[model samples]
Target: MIRIMERIALDDDELHEDFMRSSGAGGQNVNKVETAVQLRFDVRGSPNLPEGVRGRLERLAGRRLTKDGVLVLTAQRFRTQERNRADALERLVEMVREAAVPPPPPRRPTRPTLGSKKRRLEGKRIRGDVKAMRGRVEGD
Candidate 1:
């Protein structure tokens, strides 16, 4: 089981891992060994995740989320299969952690203060005066 938050814990069975050949570096080893790890988790189907977190996670997953609501994470940073697998799982945990936090309250709409409105008008008038001064001077 993985603990996402104080109240949220994900079952070990929730994660699915597949191995594939890694690209770049490792030369011959890269060609022969499957070092990359693909980790998948069902965001919508997971009973461990709260509805709020699930929705947030789905949005956060973006392109990583499939039509079936599975979140896919690929790890190929490390050359070893074990390290790549751990990296994938770590990324999944981090993503879930981000989703667990509650969103900030919506900002309240506020009207400009009377002083501020007056100041804005004053600035505009000053700018207009500056422009007016640049116009052709009348016979003085």
Candidate 2:
């Protein structure tokens, strides 16, 4: 099970992982063993994610999500296949959790209070006076 958040958990079946060659630095063992993991998740068909969250994840994934609606991630940083697999799953879960939380609604616009407006005008006036003082005291 992939636990995303307190309430969100994805079943192992929902995740697809395949072993492949890693491009990163490694010895001959790297060439022989498929240590890289490619993980794909179908956000559009997942029963685990909420409708809104799935939509958001699809959008957040951008190019990662294919036209068929699969979020694809390649994990080749780790040396071992298991490690690479775990890394991919961890990253996917984290991203899902992040996308699960919706942004807070925007606050309504407000006009500056009368006092604040007055204070701002006064500050502008003071600045203008200070700048005016910088002018040359030429004409007698």
Best by lDDT: 1
Note the Cα lDDT for every prediction shown: 0.94, 0.89
TM-score on alpha carbons, each prediction: 0.82, 0.89
Clashing pairs in 2: none
Question: Which residue runs of candidate 1 sit more than 4 Å off their true CA positions?
Answer: 122-140
Give the range where candidate 2 is weakest over 10 consecutive residues by summed lDDT.
22-31
Q: Give candidate 2's error at residue 35 in angstroms.
A: 0.5
Top model number, TM-score: 2
Candidate 2 RMSD to the real structure: 1.9
Model 1, position 96: C-alpha lDDT score: 89
